[model samples]
Target: MATQYDRIEPPLARFIARQNIFFTATATGDSRINLSPRSTDALRVLDDNRVCYLDLTGSGSETSAHLLADGRMTIMLCSFQGPPMILRLYGRARSLFHGTPEYAERLAASYDGEAPLGARQIVELTADLVQTSCGYAVPLFSHEGERDVLTRWAMGKGAEGLVAYRAEKNAVSLDGLPTGMPA
Candidate 1:
């Protein structure tokens, strides 16, 4: 069975926060699909209809490239520790690049006083529909700890180095799509 809403409700927000991992799905009009497992204290609920997350440096920038091409995204969260449930946020998203005015403004408003180290982009999600389904068959897994390797690597690079890393490693998707990463 399935249920849908115009936006995320209070209960859904609570459940999302409890999730240790979430999956992001994206695709262009024609290309390879991308489904990525994301973790960390990166996601934030801006409101019932809006969400945001920090995009860190990675080998492939499929999500950013796909979003830039198609603007559609689906984020899924499933309950692993409690009753069986799966929540999906279907929406359009825009990737804010690092060192841009929009990125700076989002950082100011979203990050408060402290800055996020090696922050590359802030993906702003505007959900058009929220859905929930029975997740009776989803497997359960325990979270160990947040992966610190990315953060440590980014920190070791410093700001300019991180930018160079993005140019070298994150500017293109595996499928050769341009991610529009900062220069």
Candidate 2:
């Protein structure tokens, strides 16, 4: 069975805080739907109806591009250890790219003025519907730890290299949609 809520309650917020991973889904009417697994301590619940995450440089900027084309997005999380629940937040979102004041403010307020190397943008979502379903079928797996490969890779690339990499790889989605990354 599934339950729905208008906002993230206290318990739900706490549940979100404990999770080590989450997934994002987005797309435009004509574009391929994009789904990606995300980790790192990148997510923040701003309020009962709002959330934000630090967007790092990656091979594809599909989420950003899809949000630019259309604001619809869904964020989902499943418990892999204890509880058997799946949480989904359906909402509209926007990507605030680097060098923008909105991104700066959000980073300072939610991320404590610290963003990981190769940080690309801040994706803020205003969730209108929150749903939870039984995740009994979701296999349980122990969380060993987060990987350091992305941080190491970013360090090796350096700031300039990160910029160039984004221009080359993160500036557009696989479907040729612009991600709004600065040129």
Candidate 3:
């Protein structure tokens, strides 16, 4: 069975804090839905109805493009090594790209300025509905640790190289939608 909440309560917040990874889903009316797994210690629950995460540079900008076209987004967190549980936040979101004032505000207020070299943007989600479902069917796997390949890659690329890479790879989604980049 599933239960819905008007806002994220204490228990739900704790569950979110314990998770090592989460997934984001977004889409526009005509674009292909985008779902990506995010790994980082960059998530923050601003309040009962608000949450934000630092989005690192990646192969696709589908989430940013889709959110720009349509504000709808869903964030999912599941327990892989704990008791069976899945939490989701459904609401509207907007992406604050690097060099934007909004992104700076979120970074200052939420993060500790320890973002990685590939940090791209901050995605803020305002929740209207929170849902929790029994994740009995979710496979239980032990978390060994996180990989540092992305960090090493970013270090090798350097800032200028990362900028060029973003220009070439993260500027647009696979659907040909502009990711509001190269600004």
Candidate 4:
């Protein structure tokens, strides 16, 4: 069975707050659907109908591009260690670049050390529907803290290296759409 809400209720918001990770999905016309496993600590539930996440510099900017073109995005979070449940947020999302005021405001209030090396943009989402279902098939695995490999790599790169890396890998989507990434 599944349940849906026009806005995130107290219990639903609590569940979202307890999760350590979330997944994001997006796509555009004729472009490849992008599903990224972003189990970061940067997501925040803003009130009952909004959520935001800090998207790091990755190899592809599909999410950014798709959001720009279509404004469609879905974020999913599953209980990996506790009860078996899956929460999905369907919404319209907008990507805020680093130099923009919106990005700065949201990033400042998001999390400590969120704007780190290789930081790219913050995705602000206005969720239209919140759904939860029994995740019977979801395998449970205890979290052992976030992996430091990516963090270490980004730290090693420093700010200058990160800028170069973004230029080479994250400037465009797989289908050649501009991701609105800051240069």
In the order shown, what is each candidate's alpha-carbon RMSD?
1.4, 0.8, 1.1, 1.5
Sorting all predicted structures by lDDT, with the top scorer first, yields 2, 3, 1, 4
What local lDDT does model 3 show for residue 41? 81
- Look at candidate 1 and tell me the lDDT of residue 6: 100
Q: Residue-wise lDDT of candidate 1 within 1-183, one digit each (tens)?
A: 999999899999999989888889999988799999887378889899998888888777899899888999999989888888999999999999887898888878887724557778989999999999999999887778887898898789998888888889888888888988877
Between candidates 1 and 3, the one scoring higher on lDDT is: 3
TM-score per prediction, in order, is: 0.94, 0.98, 0.96, 0.94
lDDT digits (tens) for residues 1-183 of candidate 3: 999999999999999999999999999889998999887387889999999999888777899888888899999999998799999999999898887888888888888655778889999999999999999999998888888888898899998998999999988888899888654
Clashes counted in candidate 4 amount to: 0
Report the CA-based lDDT of candidate 1 relative to the real structure.
0.87
* Candidate 1 runs further than 4 Å off: none
- Superposed model 3: Cα runs more than 4 Å off: none
Per-residue CA lDDT of candidate 4, range 1-183, in tens?
Answer: 999989989998888888888899999977899998886578888889998888787777899889988889999999887888999999999999876888888877776535777678889899999999999899988778887778788899888888889888888899988888777
Q: Check candidate 2 and list the clashing pairs.
A: none
What global local distance difference test value does model 3 have? 0.89
* Candidate 4's TM-score: 0.94
For this target, which candidate reaches the highest TM-score against the unseen true structure?
2
Candidate 2 segments exceeding 4 Å error: none
Steric clash count of candidate 3 = 0
